[model samples]
Target: MQSCELSVIKYILFTFNLVFAISGIGLIVAGALVLSDVGEFDHFMEGRILAPPVVLIVAGCIVFLVASLGCYGAIRESYYMLMAFALCLLIILIIELAVGIAAAVYKNDFQMTMKDLMKSSMQRFENSKGDRTAWNNIQTKLKCCGVEGPTDWPENTRPVTCCHATREGSPPPEAHHCRSAAPQDGILYMDGCFYQLQEKAESASKILIGVGIGIAFVEVIGIILACWLASAIKNKGD
Candidate 1:
């Protein structure tokens, strides 16, 4: 309510404003890349419209705009502005939460397609007509995730980083290596299993969002609260 606290709020709000803006810009760029369908699915532009990359960018834009409002409201000290920002943020947050829940629960095609990518790539190596060199080449591009046991090959990138290839020929033994996040985006696993079963990445991500969305939501709420309290303080001072 005091000028001093208001000043502090303004400073914090500005910091958040910058973060939101940068994040929004990055997501939007990445989303456009997905929508463009540059890699394997170019013809299926319509199908890619709401994929994670696009969806994330859209959400980022919304949050960025909302955080911008909070900054503006704090700088201008306008209750109307704060209220409007809070309402918009509430609506978007609800929508995002609903979509995220649906995606997590449904086991959509994205999951299957990504899984198939790994399966098909490995198949190429398996069915390579006994050409030792060709199999080695295929193995080069192939990525093995968490392995059941120590990969017969020596370690390349050790302990919680990206992936590596197999030695000259034998079945690319199970991985002794591990990863914190899947080398590929939107994919992660634990031990030898994939993330889909446990939703370790998905559910963990959701939990993180669950925690984060609230804190940001509260910050917006706090700005509104401060504005209201400021108004009351002003009136009382009069």
Candidate 2:
């Protein structure tokens, strides 16, 4: 009966390690996707926005390495390796929980800080070419004109990016019509970039928090299995 149970535990640990490896890969992909989605806007938030995804990717790599250790331990029935795997998992679980809490705090802090930073950037829009280009990119991508709305800009001075026609890959016949003066009705985007970006950031923040917490739960299970298997292996040897 002890032999039978030891074999069962070994296989189960091996299978769990396989699943854990796959989850690490999944986390890498998720982090990369999130990074690409929000990378362009990093300057606005001073790169605070990139922290969660970067953390996820780093954690994924670490998990992948630890999963390999786990698989080796399970296959060899090495008591020490299994204990080390459990310890690594416990550390990772703590880090993940901390990251989830940080993400939640950041999400709230972002709402307060974002508007001030955007408005500051807007003040530099006309004087700084970088700001102008950034604003144009945000406006074109989000289909928004200014900070709050088109009226945020001086009358008849909105950039060509504000025009829906230009945003759709169709330049106006007269650049002056799009830039110097407002075009016909429905030609320009009426929304603001701030709210659109905020929504996107909030959504990303939620994803980070959710994923971090979810992965931590998985790690707890892995820790339990690893410890249990390690103890069983030791008992069998004795």
| Per-residue alpha-carbon lDDT of candidate 2 for residues 1-238, written as tens digits (9 for 90 to 100) | 9888888888988998898998888788888888888878765765665788988999999999999999999999999999999999999888887877776667667666777777788878778998888888898788887878777777545677877664557664354565655434667778888888888877776777677777777788899999988999889888
In model 2, residue pairs whose N, Cα or C atoms come closer than 3 Å (at least 3 residues apart or on different chains), thus clashing, are none
Query: For each candidate, what is the lDDT?
Result: 0.47, 0.81
Listed per model in order, the count of residue pairs whose N, CA or C atoms clash below 3 Å is 1, 0
Candidate 1, 168-228: lDDT as tens digits: 4534223343323333432322233223222333543454355445545654554565455
Query: Any runs in candidate 2 off by more than 4 Å, and if so which?
Result: 154-157, 166-185
Q: Estimate each model's TM-score.
A: 0.46, 0.87
* Highest lDDT against the true fold, candidate: 2
Candidate 1 colliding pairs: 147-175
